[model samples]
Target: MKKTILLTLLVVSSFQNINSQEKREKDLLTSRKWYIKYMKFGENKREISDKTKNENWMLFNQNGKAEITTQGIKSIEDWNFGKKHEIINISEDGKFTEYKIEKLNESELVISRKYLNKTTTLGLKK
Candidate 1:
């Protein structure tokens, strides 16, 4: 009986820890609006000197909705994360695309997507 109780407690605590971590990640992601500050395109990871701030930005809501504006075009979308928070999925117009998260922190985020053997990475600042 003691072993069974201990095992159950451990299992419950593990689940709670996983849930808390996911929640923390989500909260960090939704805490602020992110502006595209850099791009890993032709050059190495460098700041985009030509674009103005807020010209290309994204905002995530805690309710699973997202707002993305690029070059003055705004889109309403839905977003979610993978089981381990290694990937994020954004859905627009009933279609969803998965992006691999290269880095995420309180003030910066980096994500990459692949298409036809080509990969593009975007760095965002809070």
Candidate 2:
């Protein structure tokens, strides 16, 4: 009886984990499109539509495909939420970039990445 109880608990726990993962994905990806509000590269912050005249946007699809549009050019990529939805990984042309999720909600998505002693934080709005 004890073993049976343990097995049942394990099954329930597995289902809970699956449900949590699905919920996370739905909450973060359902919007389909997110526009970059700004990006902070270390101490410098670049606002959207600044003097640079650059536009950046991201699209997340239910099929695990993502697209990044910059300067009217779109790059196709595959994307996935990291374990526990703590990060987002985007792969394109055999290159992968992982962005650690700082905050995600119905209207906002914030992520950051650190490389070569520089940290870039990007804020997005739906």
Candidate 3:
């Protein structure tokens, strides 16, 4: 009986720890300002443009809407928040793109698209 009680307690504690960790990660992701740093694709690329580093913001509205914007490009994104918050899709002007975001660390996010065949790593701004 004592052993069973101890096991149950251990399991509960483990679940609580996991829940806390997941919550922390979600908060960090939601609070961060993400930016882009573009780079050339080929090996013999001459110079990386200084203009590549552009400031971008991801704003999450109260109604579960997300907007990502840079200088000239603006996209409206959809998100769902439950145990985990996920980016579902983005529509820029009239074109639609599907994207997924994953937390690489507390300060970094990895965003990927299948049709675009691209993945971008964004760093959190202090």
Candidate 4:
């Protein structure tokens, strides 16, 4: 009986830890505006035109709304994290796209998605 109770307690603790980790990651992602620094398409890497790195940006909200601004135009979209928190889903109108998280932290984010036969990666910084 003691072993069973211990095992139950361990499982619950692990679940709570995982839940808190996911919440923390989500908060980090939604806390600030991320500016585009560069983009990589397969073997080629291209830097953003403006040295200031503020020409293009993306803002994620906790309410599942996102704003993407490029060349001074902003578009509203819906966003959600995948089940495992490894992917981000963005949808506009009826079309949707999945971005796989390559790296994420307090100040930097890197995400990649497939484009045709090549993989496109976007590097962003707060």
Winner by lDDT: 4
lDDT of 4: 0.90
Candidate 1 vs candidate 2: which has greater lDDT? 1
lDDT of 4 by residue, 1-126 (tens): 999999999999999998998898899999999999899999999888766556599999999999998767789999988887788988867577999999999999999999999999999989
Tens digit per residue, CA lDDT, model 1, 1-126? 999999999999999998898888888899999898887754456676545767788898999899998777899999999766788899968988888989889999898888666777888988
Candidate 1's C-alpha runs over 4 A off are 41-46
- Quote model 4's TM-score: 0.90
RMSD of each: 2.1, 2.9, 5.2, 1.6
In the range 1-126, model 3's lDDT, one tens digit per residue, is: 999999999999999987787566556656655554332223222332335434355655545467676654767776544433444355555555554664445556655544334443333332
Query: Each candidate's TM vs. the true structure?
Result: 0.86, 0.80, 0.54, 0.90
Error of 3 at 23 (Å): 1.3
Ranking 1 against 4 by lDDT, winner: 4
Model 3 misplaced regions, further than 4 Å = 39-55, 60-63, 81-103, 113-126
Model 1 RMSD in angstroms:
2.1
lDDT, each prediction: 0.85, 0.82, 0.54, 0.90
Ranking by lDDT: 4, 1, 2, 3
Question: TM-score winner among the candidates?
Answer: 4
**Which parts of model 2 are misplaced by more than 4 Å?**
2-11, 14-18, 50-54
lDDT, candidate 2, equals 0.82
